[model samples]
Target: MKLQLAIDLEDIQGAIDLIQKTKDSIDIFEYGTPLVINFGLEGLKKIRAEFPDITLLADLKIMDVASYEVNQAFVYGADITTILGVAEDQSIKDAVKAAHEAGKELLVDMIGVQDIATRAREIDAFGADYIGTHTGYDLQALGQDPGGIKLTAAEEIKSANPDLLIIGGAISTVDDPATAAAEFKKLLG
Candidate 1:
């Protein structure tokens, strides 16, 4: 079980500082969609330079041009990059291939896919290292909890592909990330 700290701040320095402060508590540092969109690969480069030993995840939520996007993420020093579950199967395959070529991992983000079980099965067959069920910030703001769905999908994936990682991307939405992460670790245990 790994605790990933997702950073969505517009300020790269602030994100870096937070990662520096919370480095010991989390295993992976995720550069959220907003942070990636706001600063592009430059932000990832800076963080990689600052924390060379930490695992950095680029949450690009890539839906198309999988190879190019995944390659760019790895080239910029991301240890893991994300692909959208709603993307075409070919795109998912391409992303996985790119990740393999880069010697990194691809996490498939199931953010908007309505059929959780079916899509989870399908995406799990795509050979991604991790399958993540995410509840975006807007949904979290509306008080919607996706933990149940996330756990369900995780169970399904674990049954089908026990080695594949199951990621819950809503920890950042929780009030206390450290406590939430600890609870997740306990649950996994």
Candidate 2:
């Protein structure tokens, strides 16, 4: 039931203000993919500086140069970093190792990856901290619901490794946190 607030858009200060106001209520703070792409690691560093106590996840959506990206994120104060499950197995392994070496966590983003079960199993073997059942913003904008998909992915990953932590993303509204938490509870039970 961890609530990760995704900060997207191009306004770093605006995002900082919102996070400053809401950080107490959220379990994790995420620098969204678009924001990271737009502002890079320095932007993530700024957010990290603002909230040193909070768990900061950088949604880098890393597809290549796994070690370098993960290292950069960790150095910039990211407690956790994300990698695409669709990426090469070597990349996933490298990133996972980098995360471990840096004392950080790795979140495998299972977005648009067809072999989710296989990838989940592989990530479990690599000891990823969490598996993110995520829907892209474009799909959400087109009215595709992520609840069911997230639940399904969570179930699949949990089956592979019951100890795995499942997180949901592309959750745009406030109501989504409760709904998703409830759904995840039911699935876990």
Taking every candidate in turn, the Cα RMSD to the unseen true structure, in Å, is 4.6, 5.0
Residue 64, model 2: lDDT of 100
What TM-score, to 2 decimals, does candidate 1 have?
Answer: 0.79
What tens-digit string does per-residue lDDT give for candidate 2 at 1-189? 465667775368966876665555556778888888789889888888887888888989999999999999999989899999988889999999999988889998999987778778888898888877666767878888653235567666556654434343423334445455455545554
Pick the lDDT winner: 1
lDDT of 1 by residue, 1-189 (tens): 566667875388977766765666567888888988899988999999999999999999999999999999998989999999999999999999999988999999889989978988887787888987777767877888743324345455445543333343444545555565555445442
Off by more than 4 A, model 1:
147-189
Error of 2 at 39 (Å): 1.1
| Inter-residue clash pairs, candidate 1 | none
What TM-score does candidate 2 get on C-alpha atoms?
A: 0.77
Which segments of candidate 2 are over 4 A away from where they belong? Answer: 147-189
Which candidate should be chosen as best, given TM-score against the real structure?
A: 1
Q: Residue 78 CA error for candidate 1 (Å)?
A: 0.2
